[model samples]
Target: MGSDDQGNNDVGRSGFTRRGFIQIMGTGAVSASLAGAAIAARSKPVPPEKVMDAENTVKISLHVNGAQHAVLVESRWTLLYVLREAFGMTGTKEGCSRGECGACTVLIDGIPRYACMTLAVEAEGRRITTLEGLMSGEQLGPVQNAFLEEDAYQCGYCTPGQIMAVEGLLRKNPTPSLDEIRIGVSGNLCRCGAYTHIFRAAQKAADLKKR
Candidate 1:
């Protein structure tokens, strides 16, 4: 009992040395802390709350053309995104997203509007008519036929918007004069410089629609 070797090798109280005891105490303290934290978490759970973020999508119903569509769209999604991505209506091209270019034009409640400038939520309740809408089950509408006859579209980049604008204008004034047709499609820009043929096509479309 008085020997140094015996004292060092002695099975102390709790069968642990001073160094081992200290280590066990440190481990126990950490385990207790973790258990307490877990208990506190179990005692008071977090409640569900609405989170506003880009990942959040809202359900919307859009009456496009003659069909009704129910879809989920992001908060900041533009009308073009909904038309092309959401509804697969890619005829509404995305040009200048700032509304400077009329390439993304479509009809909203029979009014010509730039889809790029419009929001998806804004068009939720409105009638959205894209280029695809102008077809009546494989039969091209008067506006589309007129464009084909007059060869109004060169590269056809701006043809969809041009056709939509003319359609909207025709809806308002079925018999638009040459100047009126020019003014109606003024918002739409034809980068291919096909204004002369486009004007002729618009006039032809009006006459065809009237019949």
Candidate 2:
């Protein structure tokens, strides 16, 4: 057609041209950041002590798995430490202490939390449930039983966290869909790639609860 038509065709039919796409993306990123800020502003703040350095030692009482503990802990020590070291609850594993790996997952107030990321002092007066807490006297709970029956673990390093996470999921959503199961355990990584079996065990756990 005309020379003008040729130039427009080289650019783009609509929106930015290929070379201008970077500029458009840069502007879009700004808008996205503003929207993110708005969302963050509405979110509740994390506890101050949770953010503060754990330099000082503090005595705190914890209600864990229906048992009460009166212990002294460092302000910097994570909940995982007290559970595994002081309390001697070794069911919780330490994968990545940075919260990226759910191997240290535990239940706090019925919610799944990364123990390594949670300050021991912050856990005071709250209910903390570790994997060992799932036992009922001499018997393993249904979730744990289902995990065993379904053979959801391999290497077993991530089993404790995986089981606890699934326990939390079933507590909140007793009959979660498969997709929900996948999403629920999304935070917990299984290097063995035993996800299908984990999902099976989670579904089995839900079914076990029904009976």
Candidate 3:
């Protein structure tokens, strides 16, 4: 081949080779750098201080049924969990966990609240009344006696919530009519069709309070 032609061919091949070689080398270096960074990040240990802080827990004091219980719980735990799991007071039943069912009912400052939906932290320094606290020593509270007299419960799973609601209603209205009592206990569900007896129980409680 002629010298000029050979020189031109060499330049053309060199241009393509240099472009492709640079691109391959650039890609390889970038990949290697990324891999090294990922490995280094994985190898680095979490600081002891950070780990300790993350592991640290908080103490919560609950005034439940006129008694104080200091419990250790996560910040996100609901009052129902604290009452049931931490304190062993399982009277607060778990039903419709998102606050629909009143099975997890408890009194906060004499008002009915869905314990499952109420945060334990929110209940700090508040007076809480659970079904466990319904009795006075060996004798059942007036509401309890009324429940028995009126045959208020069929399944009894909703009895605690129903009674709590009745107590709150009487506390507010002092003498709730039958309709008022029904509306008050509406949040509670008795799948066994005991609502009529439940309403009668509330009236009985009101009568007992008057006498």
Q: Each prediction's TM-score against the native?
A: 0.74, 0.74, 0.72
In model 1, where do residues sit more than 4 Å from their true spots?
A: 1-54
Q: What is the C-alpha RMSD of each candidate to the true structure, in Å?
A: 30.9, 22.7, 31.6
Best by lDDT, which number? 2
**If the candidates were sorted by their lDDT against the true structure, best first, what order would they fall in?**
2, 1, 3
Off by over 4 Å in 3: 1-56
Model 3, span 1-211: residue lDDT tens: 1133224333321121112212212222234334334433644323222111333456776667656667776767889999888877776788889878798899987789899888787777566888766654434567766876776776677778888888888889998888899899989988989888888889989987687
Instruction: Point out the worst 10-residue segment of candidate 3 by lDDT.
Output: 12-21
lDDT of 2 by residue, 94-171 (tens): 888999989999998778999999988888756678776676443567787776677677677888899999999999
- Candidate 1, overall lDDT? 0.73
Q: How close is candidate 2 to the true structure, as a TM-score?
A: 0.74
Q: Residue pairs in steric clash, candidate 2?
A: 54-75, 54-76
What local lDDT score does residue 20 receive in model 2, on the 0 to 100 scale?
20
Better of 2 and 3 by TM-score: 2
